[model samples]
Target: MRHIQRIHINVKSFICPNCAKSFKDNDTLQTHIKYIHECERNFCCRECEKTFVSSSDLNRHTQMVHMNLRRFLCSTCGKTFHTSSNAKRHFDEVCGKKEKKNGNS
Candidate 1:
């Protein structure tokens, strides 16, 4: 016969005072406060003068639209896409085998 012991631990959560939103971590709650509650748009695009909350978003926008960087390439058709989601959508809707619905092929 074997004996087993179980232990319970409590996790501390960070809560937003303004909207009463709760997060498991403090950094995520701080980021949400800075971006959503503060409405900060510090990052700006040089090409179109658009603003963004973060630098990564600005860089992605510039690469996708201005620099025309299509990093996601489809293996079946060799087609390029700006984002991975777009490439996956193309593969699922066009290249991959799909099931027919309501007698429509």
Candidate 2:
């Protein structure tokens, strides 16, 4: 058997002074400040009181709940979906759906 040497370590170094918060990564600490205390919830849902950081999320929620509009239709199966990607996925994986020549399915 080989002999091994032990080492001592001191790893409690990075601390946030403003909130007495500590993180292993500085980017996490900055994200906490920007997201939690900056009052920058840019995306607000129209159907409910939910808030998000991106507008795409709010638009998705609005399309799902408030508008209830389905723009995607399967050509062979005659199934309707809210988003084009979902419709395409169903056509490829689900059943009986074919893509039109114009790719409108």
Candidate 3:
């Protein structure tokens, strides 16, 4: 004899009253409200008209275009990477003989 259990997953939904746009994630919905309805462009690029939500994102964009530096480097294969995690991923995929996080070899 076996008992079967049914699991129900609740899908979260959000509705934007101002713009009539809906989203599943609260963070995205908040961002939409702040940027679209309020028109609050707090994060502005010094060199261009592009704006972002955080300073770290703007810093990364500046480093990528203005500094022209590849911060991450693969020690195993001597290959340059843009970010440290990407370097680790390349090492794992190429030399360490490990499958990617997606589990596809």
Candidate 4:
């Protein structure tokens, strides 16, 4: 209820002192401060030694880049992409012609 009131109502109460950016909640503001302002990346990728602000980001990087997991396949072009947005972009932007269907990667 609080989230809906804050986010849906566009009431950004928490303002970042450094950049003057507003956020819906304190946790988001803290996360933005920790990652953007302080540049404190805690989640490290063992595969590439790259660091990220959150564990989800590290997991995404590992799965997409290191694992080569192309799960989002373009229905029209039959091309595989690492993410759903990428596949949707292909379908929207360039996947007009039906390319030879490759089995799911």
Candidate 5:
């Protein structure tokens, strides 16, 4: 309940000593330290023999690299991209405001 409360309240109690990043829960903080700082790749892809620090990353790599799944498509040019962020970037370059520079619109 305390962990859930921290997330809802946006109170980051656990702070990483190495990078000074904050997490709402201890488990997330520990995972960040293990994966980001320690570079522990627990999940591995057998097909490509590549390792990922997290399972979701391994899944994304398998879908994009091995399966060649480009789910996101740019509406303007009809270009395909593996990630939604890439598609949105292409869309912004094509139709919307130019890609952000120095965090400005």
Candidate 6:
């Protein structure tokens, strides 16, 4: 007879000391600390000389501003957006039937 052993894998979490924000990985936690707490902008845009906290933000800026790429489009209003979230926001705020309270809408 042979004996079999099982191993358990735990979900590793990294916590921020300042704001108590949690992350799944150490690299993500470090990045959050560097960008949010430390205010480090290592990524720079060559076109407009703007600094960004991450490369993804710089790439988004370049695509939207320099490349003029509007990938997300609103079906109702025929408006275009660079990101999906913005289009969704427009739909919720402008197009959706949800009532506006406190003069916000």
lDDT by residue for model 2 over 1-105, one digit each (tens)?
A: 111211133333446667777655566777777766674777888668799777887887888778997888887778899988899889777663334544665
Would you list the clashing residue pairs of candidate 3?
A: none
lDDT of 4 by residue, 29-86 (tens): 9999987999878999998799998899999899999999899998765899998998
Question: Candidate 1 — which residues are off by over 4 angstroms?
Answer: 1-33, 98-105
- Best candidate (score: lDDT): 4
Question: Pairs clashing in candidate 2?
Answer: none
lDDT per model, in order?
Answer: 0.80, 0.70, 0.70, 0.85, 0.84, 0.80
Which of the two candidates, 3 or 5, achieves a greater TM-score against the reference? 5
Tens-place lDDT digits, model 5, residues 13-33: 899999999898889999988
Off by over 4 Å in 2: 1-39, 96-105
Residue pairs in candidate 1 whose N, alpha carbon or C atoms collide under 3 angstroms? none
Distance (Å) between predicted and true CA of 75, model 1?
0.5
Per-model tally of clashing residue pairs: 0, 0, 0, 0, 0, 0
> Model 5 — which ten-residue stretch has the worst lDDT?
96-105
Off by over 4 Å in 6: 1-31, 98-105
Q: Summarize candidate 6's per-residue lDDT along 2-57 as a digit string, tens digits.
A: 11211133443579998998776677889888879999788999999999987999
RMSD of each: 7.3, 11.1, 7.8, 6.1, 6.5, 8.6
Worst 10 residues of 6 by lDDT: 1-10
Off by over 4 Å in 4: 1-8, 11-13, 25-27, 34-42, 53-55, 96-105
Alpha-carbon shift of residue 6 in model 6 (angstroms):
28
- Total clashes for model 2: 0
